[model samples]
Target chain A: MGNVAYAVLSSDEQEVSIMEKKIQWETELVHALQRSKVEKRPILLDFHNPH
Target chain B: MDTVTYPQQSVVTFIEHNLIPLRVGSDTQPLASDFAVTWTPTLVLLDPQGKEHHRTVGFFDAEALIPSLLLGLGKVEYDSNKFKEALGYLEKLLAEYPESDSAPEAIFLTGVNRYKSTGNPLPLKEAYEQLQRMYPASTWTKRAYPYRLLG
Candidate 1:
């Protein structure tokens, strides 16, 4: 989960929140990809609901 | 999936801690004057000699962003018409996801395309100002100012 690099250039804490969300999304993406690989199906990625 | 390269190697140096390229510097100083520095992410495009090319500040959706970065880096043949079409898709995405992380950039691109198409500048200024007011602390606001007010 922490392996992916989160890149940002802002000092605002709000941006940090964004990064957190991005990280969560990336984690979900990886999980979904893993599941898809096991199931042998293409996974759909949606921003609204990662689960 | 296409590969593109700049005349020179460009870098997206993440200024914030914990981000990729994890670099640190004085908060008081400009990160790159010689290379085009985009904010919120500070993506820099450089010439062969490492001179500034173009800068953008804000997060871009896959539609508008992927192409814009490719064109800026001289990675592929960019058709302005194709980019305009892509901007339409980005605008719709913003309308659907107004609070998405990429919203501000979509707003900026809308105004930018409008201004470019009609030369009104009013829409562009208004859009840029919206970003400034909404995301006051955003580093992107700094770049939007000169374009919104002066040019």
Candidate 2:
């Protein structure tokens, strides 16, 4: 039982680590544009299909 | 892009450090029309004032994407009259990823920036020769055809 529990915890930790590597995309274009202007950074607009 | 490209460490770090990344649906309003994005998964890089400097359609892997983004950043600087800064980015792309999809464009633009800054046609001539030698069949080589007449 302890061994099974350890395996589950390891799996969960691996899942979390994978999730953490994904990019956190900003959803609001207006806000992103404003922030980019303020931050003096270029805006990378990604037009993607939700479907 | 999310599952394959964006998850790469180098791509994520580059975007985070140099760009304000925004993801929107293709159907998103005036912004989509403003950029004339007719295709899904189109990536457009805009200057701070919302002027577009570069765009690419379709999906790209991390290796292809980085050089493209770097070229866009170089164009942004070039459009802003920062020729020296633009050359720095373009030269770096050429040095590191000479075979990248964006490399031909970077090489072409390096010549343009050099000519613009130094008022010498030699760089343009060299660019034309390089493009002809390295990417004979590429459209970039065709675009540099006019430079051949400069001699």
Candidate 3:
């Protein structure tokens, strides 16, 4: 059931819930693909210009 | 996208439910050079092996984004030869977001997915007809022009 990996943004339980409600973005492509394979889900890779 | 699209509740939920979201700076490392990042907000869908199935360069609002991602997921399944699974995603996109920018392409792929799964060319012809009737000016309609002769 717990197949998807969540990126923990905060340690607080309340903050964790709030974070979970948002898109959990993984920073590393390698890590993202690893989770993707395990979950059998595709990866939505967004390359944004931070400027 | 950060300021507008991604923050939308529907977009967040859709993405969280179906995809592994990865965010990276365009200028970030080997990936930038590998994927050829010459622009901002380039969204690419990759299989777990890092094979790209679909890509959209530039911006897409929440309405457009959902269908595009659905098409990508369908493409991923199509590429993997999972025709039934591909149809599931493509059909959902067409049924839910038929007026979206991604709809024409979804229709085109839905036809192809149907043909591949059933070994029937009739679906391809029907796809062309549907595209002609629904989106006569779409590029997908043009792309499926040859499919019109499939019957």
Full-model lDDT for every candidate: 0.43, 0.89, 0.92
Candidate 3, residue A17: CA error in Å?
A: 10
Return the clash pairs for model 1, or none. Answer: none
Q: Provide the lDDT at B100 for model 2.
A: 96
Residue-level lDDT of model 3, residues B45-137, one tens digit each, is: 999999999999989999999999999999999999999999999999999999999999999998998998899999999999999999999
lDDT, ranked from best to worst: 3, 2, 1
DockQ result, candidate 3? 0.56
State the fraction of real interface contacts model 1 keeps: 0.00
Better of 1 and 2 by lDDT: 2
Question: For model 3, how does the per-residue alpha-carbon lDDT over A1-51 read when each residue is reduced to its tens digit?
Answer: 479877755569767566646788999988998999999989999999877
Candidate 2: give the clashing pairs.
none
Model 3 chain B worst lDDT window (10 residues): B1-10
Q: How large a fraction of the reference contact set does each model reproduce?
A: 0.00, 0.86, 0.94
TM-score of chain A, predicted model 3, versus the true chain A, to 2 decimals? 0.57
The alpha-carbon RMSD values of the candidates against the true structure, listed in the order shown, are 16.8, 3.2, 8.0
Candidate 2, residue B78: lDDT: 98
Question: Candidate 3 at B134: error in angstroms?
Answer: 0.3
What 10-residue stretch in candidate 3 chain A is worst by lDDT? A8-17
Angstrom error of the Cα, residue B137, model 2: value is 1.1
